[model samples]
Target: MARLKKTVAMVGMMGAGKTAVGSAVARALRVPFLDSDEEIVKAANSTIAEIFERDGEPFFRARETEVLGRLLRGTPCVLSTGGGAYLAESNRRLISEAGVAVWLRADIDLLWQRVRHKTTRPLLRTDNPRETLRKIYEARVPLYGLADIVVDSCPDLSVEEMAGRVIEALRQRPDVLEGE
Candidate 1:
């Protein structure tokens, strides 16, 4: 079995396949898969959209950080975070210190295609969601670039294929993965 030395935090846009690809990566690596969003939802007993609608984004963000820190302090697994998780300096520092951040980079169009029909995204509930997504993409790319590794996403790539790419990228950092 492949040994994971640190938590592999998957950071990217809303539809960048972080959860799907991260789950596959964890399975391939024989590690657990933890999603911050899911954790938050579980703790609050509500969906992310509900959390945002009731308590506000700040509240949700605090919960996100708490969940991330809690998970990172536990086992070395693949952790998928919400799109805005990496934007906060505190979150970035926490992730960098305890885990390795892998940015699943996808183009604006691909991200839009994947998320356009999803009503779960609270951030994209604007008058023009595509434009809103574009703006978000522009703002977050630099922060996402701060990740330790970057795995490019393509429209043609399957979730398994993307997971394979992440595995290859993790292989470059022997301290992160062993017995690859």
Candidate 2:
């Protein structure tokens, strides 16, 4: 088994499979899997949509940063962050300092296919969701590009296969994973 030395923070657009693939990666690595949004929801006792509807994006982002910082400070694990988490310089710095940020690079079309039906995504609750998704994708890709590692998310790859690819990428970073 490979030993995880730093948290693996998954960053990307919505529907990039951060939660799904991160959980699979954690299972393969025998480490815990955490979702920053989930942590925020838990702490607030409300769903992400509720938080957004009640307190707005800025408030939600603040809570996200707090949850992310707390999670990154814990033992090594796979942490899945919300789509906008990496946009903040503070969050990026915190992740870079305490973990490895892995961007799951998926095309806008694929992201749409994955998230179009999901009502849980508060960001896409727009008048023209497709256009909104595209704009959001365009705006965030550059920030996500700054991640420590990039794993292309292909339509043909199953969740386990994607997790394997992430693990393979981590193997190259000896400081992040060792003891294979």
Candidate 3:
């Protein structure tokens, strides 16, 4: 088994399989899996959409940052973040200092296919969700590019296969994943 030396922060769009693949990776690595969004929801005793509706995005983002920072400082694990979490420079810096970010790159079509029917996404409740998703994708790609590693997501791939691909990428960095 490969040992995870630092937290693996999975960063990408909402439908890019961050939580799914991150959990798989954590299982494979025999580590705990943590989702920042889940933490926020637990703390607030509200769903993400409710948070957005009640307190707005800014407040949710602030809580996200707090959860992320606290989680990253703990033992190494797989951490799945909200889509907008990596957009903040402060969060990015904390991830860089405490862990490695893996951007799950997926096409807009794939993202839409995965998320279209999911009402849980607070950001995609717009009048034209497809167009809204496209706009968000365009705006965030550059920031995601700053991650330490990039794993392209294939629509045809199973969650385990994508997790394998991410683990392969992490293996290249000895500082992150040590020994097989």
Candidate 4:
């Protein structure tokens, strides 16, 4: 069997619109759309928070590695990873080796507006949500910058537009030229 093309992996801080943008990109590419968070829940048969609560964040992160590794082993698809997944060196190494990673760079205020209403975030549970985000952004932005491409997650860009940007960026990367 032939090796599949390098998948498009989307990474960024929480609320960077990976899910929304990845889905659109997958649709445009007419390939599978896999969210690592959703896949982790399916593989574990529990919510993300529940996994963290039951097994601890480290254990849950291990699951993230296992599941993401399996996904990367499969055919190329658009993959939306959990916010914290890239923090692990193993995860980042796997993604860099297997596919193109796109960082959807979103401003803090935009992230705040999008995430303020959601309670599903495990890391965002804090006395100061703004501070939490700032700290996370501070830690992850540089890490995310290591990706092959970075697309701005500005509010003005529709999902389709972001998807287009991703595709355009993908076309520019010689490393992702596994398929014609």
lDDT of 2 by residue, 37-133 (tens): 9899899999999999999999999999999999999999999999999999999999999999999999999999999999999989999999999
TM-score of every candidate: 0.98, 0.99, 0.99, 0.93
- For 53-123, candidate 4 gives per-residue lDDT tens digits of 88999999999999999999888999999998888889999998888788999988999899988999888
For residues 57-95, write the lDDT of model 3, one tens digit per residue: 999999999999999999999999999999999999999
1-180, model 1: which lDDT tens digit per residue? 678999999999999999999999999998999999999999999999999999999999999999999999998999999999999999999999999999999999999999999999999999999999999999999999999999999779889999999999998899999884
Model 3 residue 155 lDDT score: 84
Give lDDT per model, in order: 0.95, 0.97, 0.97, 0.87
Clashing pairs counted in every model: 0, 0, 0, 0
Clashing pairs in 2: none
Candidate 4, residue 144: lDDT? 89
**lDDT winner, 3 or 4:** 3
For model 1 the TM-score comes to 0.98
RMSD of each: 0.8, 0.5, 0.6, 2.6
* Model 4 Cα shift for residue 7 (angstroms): 0.8
